[model samples]
Target: MSDTAREGDAEGSGVSEGASGRTDAHESGAERTAASDESSTDAREPPRLDGWPLVGNTVEFVRDPFGFYDRLESRGDAVRYSVAGDEFCTFFDPDYVEQILVAENERFRKAQILRDSAAGFAEQGLLLTEGEVWRDQRVRIQPAFTPEKIRGYADAMVTYADRLCDNLADGEVVDVGDAMSELTLKILAKSLFDVDVAGRRAVVREATAALNDRGDASGASAFLPDWVPTPKNRRFERAMSDFESMVDDLIAERRTGDESEYDDLLSILLDAEGPDGTTMSEAEVRDQMVTFLFAGHETTSLALTYAWHLLGRNPDELERLRAELDAELGDRRATMADLPDLPYTDRVLKETLRLYPPAYVIFREPTEDVRVGPYHVREGTNLTLPVFEIHRDDRFYDDPDEFRPDRWRDDFESELPDYAYFPFGGGPRHCIGMRFATAELRLVLATMARELAFEPTYDGDPDLTMAATLRPENPLEMRVERR
Candidate 1:
């Protein structure tokens, strides 16, 4: 999917060139606004297509994101554009993305639209909060993702994979995406709270389906305010509430009743105490549990689903993966101990992450004035770092448009810049459950490789649709064959 990076610099990170993107000046987020202005002011602005009145590329961007982002990066690392009254300068450069994530944490923050859209969801988890609120949540929940704990979940992951394998015969057509979603949701749900949800599938499915449906563009909350009285908004609230309630009840059961009743992820979270021996409040605990259940499930499920799609379409890669797994762990489920030994399999996952990163667009607002490249970014300005674009940029990769897992060789480790390959972001604000997600993905992939082989029945051109995260737009049909 990417070319071997020439140097060890983290991909899409460090040291910017000159002017390509600019933002409206704001006074509050002052420090966010850096690097000598001389280089920026002299550099010519990048080319941009005109949009109606003030809404530049908003409609077109929403309609065709890949095309929208590709056009911006066609000329240089960064591109300038607008969305109605909001002026945005997107950074596809690795250095720029790197700086935003690692170098300038406080300079940039999550955008207002997301902040408000998820405001109602704030009490539901850690992802929606910023600053101290986010830090506090992270403190209490971090222990659940420790290497030792993630290792424990590997057995459960394999068990779920076995259950998934049992559901589909060797040569039956099935939607791999749907299957992976269910399997991942079940594993994540149980891993977080040791509860049997054989009866609760409908409840979980309904809530997840609603979150998935939020991708709709019609009166979309992305465009409309959350307070709007639209049916979609109401539905969103209803579904989210149902989802949150399910998690809240589970937390209550564990805290008050026999704590040993379950050994799931939620239980781990409940039993965890921060460095200061602080425990999460009941609301915070519920929020983090819900957060892990959803965050830990949906995105990776999407990634693995796409990986299956990619492999099903590309027989060569598929064979290579199976061969690797067979050679590495024949007839055995992938244990946490085997993770490091299967570098090639891990590389394949990394490549998939690069090509189809779960969290494609991580948007943040400038809490302080910051300098991105040569331009000074004012406070209140929206900053969108498109990993989807950065991953495909030809500057760092040899063949930017093609898919090739082999490109992630040992040689590129020191060569790629820090932020260039951020499927799971960077800095203190990165995805907290990264280690856990990695272990979970490896377990599922390895298990499926061992127990089953799913090939796309008819090649389906799965479209990338964004809703909270990117997912396969259409049903991904596959022919499942047992190994």
Candidate 2:
């Protein structure tokens, strides 16, 4: 929305930063190259990493993406590499990240890989749509996530957190990831859909796991054509069938009820009208529901799972969190009102997200060739903003890998560059449910922390996997003790 973002409208122009920290106009890459000495090398092309013939960086990237990214980051802020035959350029600098995601976002669209992977399940939803369709979808859905609506959903969040805590017996050993997934699914269902999905948990969980497995960018089937009947594809199809049936049932049931009485996302989508006085078709509504179901709960559950994992590893921080919770809401349920009084709890979640952001990477593709920082990125280049790498970059945080909530105590976020800590992304296209997720995380963590303490069953770091969301390669088990 800034003026800097609009300068890209002119062809053969580039954007660069001045000494005053404002974007300055510059000649296009070709123009600059032509004007310079013929013997001098062009600064437009980014440094490219050498890889094996044909396969390129596929093996290294598939085997250990984190390490591959580490090596990529070491090369330069703007580094280019190949995965199989596909081209990719990762932007590690926050300024370039800001340009891609916020300032000059209009010049980019969602990555083709993402669209291809998500199309089957999330078709035409806000997640995959572009231009006017996406804008209209966002406009229609915006009211459901307003401040008032989010505040209204807080009671459901706290109630479900309380329910999960009450149900967990003392000395119970549970997979923290699965547990959080179930809890968040319930919270999302009740708060957003105004429906109770307690009986449908198994189907939802299976479907979600299947979706994650199929959509794993690192999986073997990632590059295969979707029509290929690979084992993973078969499983994905079955799961999609079951999930679509469930969605259809939910929609039918909602329609049978007093639609005017409900103010949830389902009702909103059912009744929403666009500026042209159009309503979402049945398929569009289904797409929106599917998008929210996967996105709304998956990221938050991962956040809580990592929060507990981090707390379990750092007992001192856990003690500090429990102390804050005790002082703020002793023997009582946590509500939205208690969030202000529980700063340490908030910081713990913030630090957890910083270390283990569920939406670890944001993918974008340039709609036009544009200059980012000192490099000229060609149109259709797959650009990756590695949020995880940025968060743990030593230049940005001291002891970046350490679990230290106190570091976020005050002025920390204010001092950092805008894109330095974008867990939920940024710009007009930022996650629509950010407010809802933030409030849910705080309330749920507060409620659960008040009644239960987690002891991590594993030692040291858990093996991580890159997927639709960042997940533990193995189940993260934790022993729950009643507080």
Candidate 3:
């Protein structure tokens, strides 16, 4: 079960979530006033959340990350510790998360763990790069995900969802998680690659799952070198080899085929100019395609999985959601234009993300010394910002653990800290696929809810496991009833 303990409350301290400038020394000093006695710096070191010797917090964290981070919040705003011989100071404050991700972004880079974890598969993709390289790649890729372009895929999303649902019977039990996975992948492949992956869906799913599981396992073994061929590493290598081969075949086929009718993301990426004004190389294009394939579908599927599970647990909320969908899109499929009218559906997605953000935690490393709250973190020190913990912090949320989409019905975005609910992350590195994912989620939910009402058979919240994204420990099995 998820822990709901409130060990300490250091409210009204730290930089204001909306503060425009880097946190001033005065503010940092003021925030220190609320730090626990253990955090006081007479000893000249930050408060350490000590764990088992040598291996440190690695084992415990891998075993129960949610509970470990939940308990750490009570320790202090900045809690220092060693995991796998590497020192880290986790910042549970939104102000700190914003500083690292935005205002002082230039002073930090993507965490080594994140880069290493995705390196072999997503080598030099936008997600792992920093500095001018990332800037150029972002510029080149930005056009493919604009509002207008994403809207163009609406019909494809609805069409694919309908087709997927056609395979379901009104009274049969289905693995909702697996179903969503296939549906989202099909939609992504058709809309972005302009290809149908229905025949290869199982291969793509299996490969992605293996990669994610291996990534999570590698992350847990914090100090292990990437070159080491552990069992999980070997599995990842095999999966990557298969995934790359498939992606290569797709790219080669697209290259040799006629381009006059091509208007998909792959075509745009191929035609995009690099910083030097030359066309991107085939290798670069392949890297980007692989990155998008994994990102564009994986987390979105997980979000849908969590949405159904959350709705099933809260029938009243589910009813309200269904009412909105029924009234706004009665007996009709949802289009991109209708998304604005489905306020309750939007709120439910926001609430589901708040409770179970797919990209739940982010890791970073400072390029220079940084002062966050009362602590002085040295340059190159690893820092972790747990969005999962931050979202549930009582200072920013009421009854933070409860499911309440109603909170978003109000102008909660303006009322709360900007960083409080960053499901897509923040700053320049914010997910480029944000617009596409939102439109896809809203449209899929509208279509699915309009056609069928799901009744989850499980008794409690779906068990969570740490993967490339947070996923259910088991397939989200539910009884599907056509409406």
Q: Rate the local accuracy (lDDT) of all candidates.
A: 0.68, 0.79, 0.75
**Candidate 2 lDDT for residue 84:** 56
**Residue 360's lDDT in candidate 1:** 85
Clashes of each: 43, 0, 0
TM-score against truth, every candidate: 0.86, 0.91, 0.89
* Local accuracy of candidate 3 as per-residue lDDT tens digits, 190-289: 8899988878776688778876777663255424666788876777778878877888989888989897678878987888777688877777787888
Q: Which candidate's TM-score is highest?
A: 2
Give lDDT tens digits, candidate 1, residues 1-483.
122221112222111200111111111112333442334445444345567775667887776767777777775666667764576777777666656665555556788756655656645477887766666556666556666677788888989987787778878898887788788888877676777666776666676666656544322356666778677678878977887788777766666888876655576567766657876667777777666767778888888988887777777887888888889887777788887788777887888888898888888877766567655666676678888877877767889766788888867744765467778765556666666677788888888876777787765557767767777777888898776
- For model 1, give the 10-residue run with minimal summed lDDT: 17-26
Q: After superposition, how far is residue 85 of candidate 1 from its true place, in Å?
A: 3.3
Candidate 2 per-residue lDDT over residues 240-295, each given as its tens digit: 78887898899999999888999889988899898899889999998888889889
Weakest ten-residue segment in model 3 by summed lDDT: 1-10
Candidate 2: list runs displaced more than 4 Å.
1-43
Question: How does model 3 fare in lDDT?
Answer: 0.75
**Residue 19 miss distance in model 3 (angstroms):** 16
